[model samples]
Target: MSASPKYSVELIDGPSRVQFTSASSILRPDGYHPAGAPHLISSATAEVYGNPKATKTIRIGNGGLGPTGALRQLCLAFLGERPDLRIDWVVNHSRHTQVALQAGSIDVALTYEREEEQAAETEGWSRTMGILCHDHFIIAGPRQDPAGLRGLHGSVGRANDVEVSKVKPLSTVAFANIARSQSTFHSRGDGSATMHRELGIWDSAGVPPREQGWYKVIAGTPLAALQRAAADVAYLLIDRATFLYAHHIGAVRDVEVFVEGGSELMNTTCILVRTEERRGAVLEFVEWLQGTEAQAIIERFGKNWELGVPLVTPVSQLEVAPHGKRS
Candidate 1:
């Protein structure tokens, strides 16, 4: 009898039509025939080539535990936009999202801020999709109330004597105290844009280091910073989502949300599709992300009380609740 043909399809781009054969024994049981080429895509090139027409495999680059990763998962499940889509996820610090997307290593990416997209354009790449979710930067520290930020704020009955004493210059006092007390201050790495933003406030307020010993720097992701704070019982700046998730993982324990209510404290996240060709696909996925179905999944997927839905706030007007204030 003649052999039944099991035809294989090979996908390639550009004029290099060279073909090579793979060893028969190496074929995957799942039928994934390994290609005999580099078979790697840079994020920048992917942006130019566009996303695959019909969902096949999507290379998704994610930064970290914050909203970026959460948003991607929501797009996958509730949106049902790419049901069969296989996502190759690369998780790392938040800053890598743009680099991976631009390198063509990923087809789509979730990130924060618009500046990353601008950089993509300078390199001849287009960011086809966007979403603005309200995120907040918060202060997490040991539950012991060390610097007595909690004590300073005080309770309703006693009132925050320290806070009340510095009413006219509350922001200044807060920054100065954190700057002066090493025990009260720590941050996640020097390159972190968010950390830089906070430092800027200290500069503007003329809050000099209370003493060289009063400040410390912890280098890592939100989760790492959270862990450092938990271990040393020190204060560190972190995003709300990470703080919540870190607590659930037990990476950090006995922590509390001590700070809120500031212009610099408000944070936001966004999505960026690598190329113009895949704009439709990216938008479809983004819409699904914001859809009620996806939001529900997001609500459940995050760590116990640690994960939160992206902020659905208009950029023009943003506000956060005060420490003792309730909305």
Candidate 2:
């Protein structure tokens, strides 16, 4: 039948061009292809090319458990405002994100790991653009409050005794009590921002090295670690956003916010941009995040009927420097 009159078809859509032949099919360079189709021989690969003046793609590395979602929303809004730009988000915890930013794999990073930020600045690999938002860390535990941390909530603001004033904050004192009582305590131990804060609290409390039986370290995300804490009735240090989100979604029911509020528990999320060719766009995005419109979105995030409270406060509401330093 003379190969049924062999025909060639070329389809050009957006930034990709696909060619199909009667004898064979080829994969497209856009990384997409029709499913449930047999692979064919006679390879004639498709070619994909962007227009000479097409929009640029900005890659962002994010390392926060709760703020990641809100940042993605802000990115969508920015993209809408600037059609000439697109975004590719690399979501990982603070450690991995910091590594990626240092390795030149990402253009900008939204991170909460203070050590990583300091190290990057010292190494001259990245510089802080501004503070994105802030959320307080809260100690969550079973409603029964085995460590009696609920009572310490009142002491969050006052230091009645000189020894208490010299000691760590009330939240850290709660951790100290938990350690002394041999009550179960869950630690993320995954180099996340939350873990960083938790470690500081433990250090300030002068708690000994984590014991294996009572102190459990889960090398996982905050949400997963919180779930483990709930299952085991252990105490946990978590950002307000993650706790509230989990509570709203029914991921956390037995746990209650035991201790919160204080300068020690203030968590600031910062924007760090790599020193690279796309510095201008990265800086623009960072500046936009602190603007009125972006701040509005951040202030309202996680404030739906299910949660009834916002995850983070806008940076404008606080006295944070443009470079994310305390003013």
Candidate 3:
């Protein structure tokens, strides 16, 4: 830690509820911290009146829910004390940071999007370089199904592919292809980067726009839209972190994650490093992440493995995508 602390940079995809608790445990007193994501958009106008040159490092922890978790709070505190400094922050998804890092664009990334490229760092790409966190997916739906999710539930349609509804131990929403319902399926709106990933899954499944009938695009955070789903019993997709918090607060509960304990299921976060400067301060940060302290924070923070959702392989394994990008 530099005593001068003169630079400010945004950290993307962090500061979850658990991360906040863990952050409070280790952050040094008198340090500056700032928390702001689109969820905490109010923080954006907090004012940066301090000397830009005086700050050594302005760290931004990326997390979508709100000014959540400890890392972001600490960063806000640091910035509050000294607003003047060179600051660069990118509070987006992990994939964004991963691309930036590999492309040599960012200094560091606190992300959940697993980078397949990092497979080179390990043998056979089996061991990905990342600090794992708890994450999972859930499907939301209407209590009654006009699209036939209820009828299709646990009922297999394909034979050679030998698909069975499987009637998952936990029930979320029925998985339907794009060809099935255009107006039936729902997700975040067009600008939402995450929606791109959802769209890709449909693409991978060979679900086409023509296949969809009742699909609708709603603009809002996962939790917000999830709430809407609950009210209307409309179907929606959600990440585990958001699901946990939402479920905890009773923001939404009827929906559940149908997929669990399979080769395809995974939930984890990672620290991304720009390929260009994989040395010095940047490397130190990456190494620090892998170290006991950083890993401890991530391990103990927002994501909960005890909930029984294991952090498995990289996102590359899933139809997970960025900007509707395909693998």
Candidate 4:
């Protein structure tokens, strides 16, 4: 008869998580222990503490705003102190960002669509941290001004002189004229936050661009749409930052700012945290972004460079309502 064999097996649980692999050894007929055959481990258990410092990457989705570049620069500067930290930026339109956030593909999103933000909050998928900055949308077109928006600008200037409400009425009239004249208007058409704003303006004006030959939908980024507009000598509704960036980069020379400085044209970028798992880092980043140091960086963004003008106004200087509440 073979001699009985004795062996020991143990599992230790420590404060930190640990994984274990199983190995089986056979006792030889001569009472000699043989090396275990190499086999795959069937199962293992690991404990995770969910430490923020242990996180490898902080995923961020940007909605293609000009200020996003400054935000990325600030993030890199902040990460320099913590060599262990990293950032993964997913630059997309605001609508796509919302989808990614809801799908848990990204941890946070920076977007300019207030309605989408409110919907996410209502759906309990995310919450807005705060307003990062405010930028105004401007109508740009060929220097010839085919739509004759100068008259509208003059009217707005006169209204400002008298402290009367100018943005809504003038904007309505401008859209009416665009529709009336059938002037070519290039739309982002990419379901971006900017596109959402454009739709709102059209809706308020009671003139939908649907089936309108003069309204062209360019399904691309804001910059791409702007380039197409410039090439076609068409009018385009673009954010101030993107227009200035294009000018700075010499991407478009023919398009000029036709109409600006309206409350309805206000573009508010809001920060949102997708989940609670990375809430610690996200909250810290948000607090830092809203602080004086970060605000100062935002205030100086795109200034003294080739643009010669700041792309976005900091939240501090702009009076903005919190997300879900618009003034």
Residue pairs in collision within model 4:
none
lDDT of 2 by residue, 217-259 (tens): 7766677788889889889898877787677777777788877
Model 3 agreement with the true structure over 1-327: per-residue lDDT tens digits? 734222223323334221111111111121112333211121121222235465354333244423233343323433454444423454444433343343233455555544343542331212234653444554546555444544544554331243424453222124442234433566675333355445545544444432344666676667677787677656666665565556555566556443333323344555544334434544544565555554444334443523432122222334222221000
Model 1: residues with Cα > 4 Å off, grouped in runs? 1-55, 66-73, 78-83, 115-124, 151-173, 208-211, 296-327
Q: How much lDDT does each candidate structure score?
A: 0.50, 0.65, 0.42, 0.64
Clashing pairs in 2: none
Residue range 112-147, candidate 1, lDDT tens digits: 545545665554554645554556677667777665
Model 4 poorest ten-residue lDDT run? 39-48
Candidate 4 residue-wise lDDT, 228-316, digit = tens: 99899998888877887787777887787766765778887888886454556667777787788778877888776664567788887
lDDT of 3 at 48: 24
- Model 3 lDDT vs. the true structure? 0.42
Worst 10-residue lDDT window for candidate 3 reads: 18-27
Can you give the lDDT of residue 88 in candidate 1? 51
- Angstrom error of the Cα, residue 268, model 3: value is 3.5
Highest-lDDT candidate: 2
Off by over 4 Å in 3: 1-54, 58-89, 98-106, 112-129, 132-134, 142-155, 158-173, 177-183, 189-193, 209-211, 278-282, 302-327
lDDT sort, best first: 2, 4, 1, 3
